[model samples]
Target: MSLLLEREDATLEIVDDSVLTICGEADFDSAGPLAQAGRHWLAEQPAQTEVSFDLTGVQIASSAVLSVLLVWVRSVQRHSLRLNRVSLSPALQRLMDITELAPLLPAVETTCAEPARDRR
Candidate 1:
């Protein structure tokens, strides 16, 4: 795992060079730097074709956090990388649901410990 950006209330890191895990609280005060750092990290990774974001550690899902996620979405597109998954925290999920942005984010609800099974 590699540390990408660290703020007073949050941290961004890349795990196995593919999973970007964001933890703690983030607001408008920290959004810009977080987004900028994410872009830089994406640019530096030339061998990564797919990426996943683990936002489950986030404690505060503010609009600024959503903005950061959007920035990441755009960055991955600009870098010619596929966004394989985005694991959201309950707070983030509610924000996405309220904003009707779930479709845009491609949220993944499965855990990595086991294979995804059919519910029906």
Candidate 2:
């Protein structure tokens, strides 16, 4: 799994105050890097940091990965930071819907109007 955490499109222009944008895959194997990058950014910022997770590139994710993401979200909430603009895959969206995690994941937005076909 490829996980890249960097400035979007090399623009180098900060979109929001204390906001860190993450774009890449979030899965069991890639969750470590994603979590690490998020933690590092949070540590660098003072307070009320906003982390936007762009999941447009993410193709697959497991329950473990979802748990990891939830942990990060909780940490951000505890620190009073804002987690916004979270994009999710259709499969993940369904999982969140089924598990009633949509309320917890307020930052995540549904990109797919229809439910994804479950391969599992």
Residue 76 of model 2 has an lDDT of 78
> Which ranges in model 1 have alpha carbons more than 4 Å from their true place?
106-120
Best-fitting candidate, scored by TM-score: 1
Full-model lDDT for every candidate: 0.76, 0.53
Candidate 2's C-alpha runs over 4 A off are 1-25, 106-120
Q: Could you tell me the TM-score of candidate 2? A: 0.62
Residue-wise C-alpha lDDT for candidate 1, range 1-87, written one tens digit per residue: 788888788888887778887777778888888888888887766644778887777778799998998998888877777788888
Model 2, CA-based lDDT:
0.53
lDDT of 2 by residue, 41-106 (tens): 555655666666444344554675567567667767777776666656676667767777767765
Candidate 1's C-alpha lDDT? 0.76
Pairs with backbone N, CA or C atoms under 3 Å apart (clashes), candidate 2:
none
Q: Lowest-scoring 10 consecutive residues by lDDT in candidate 2?
A: 6-15
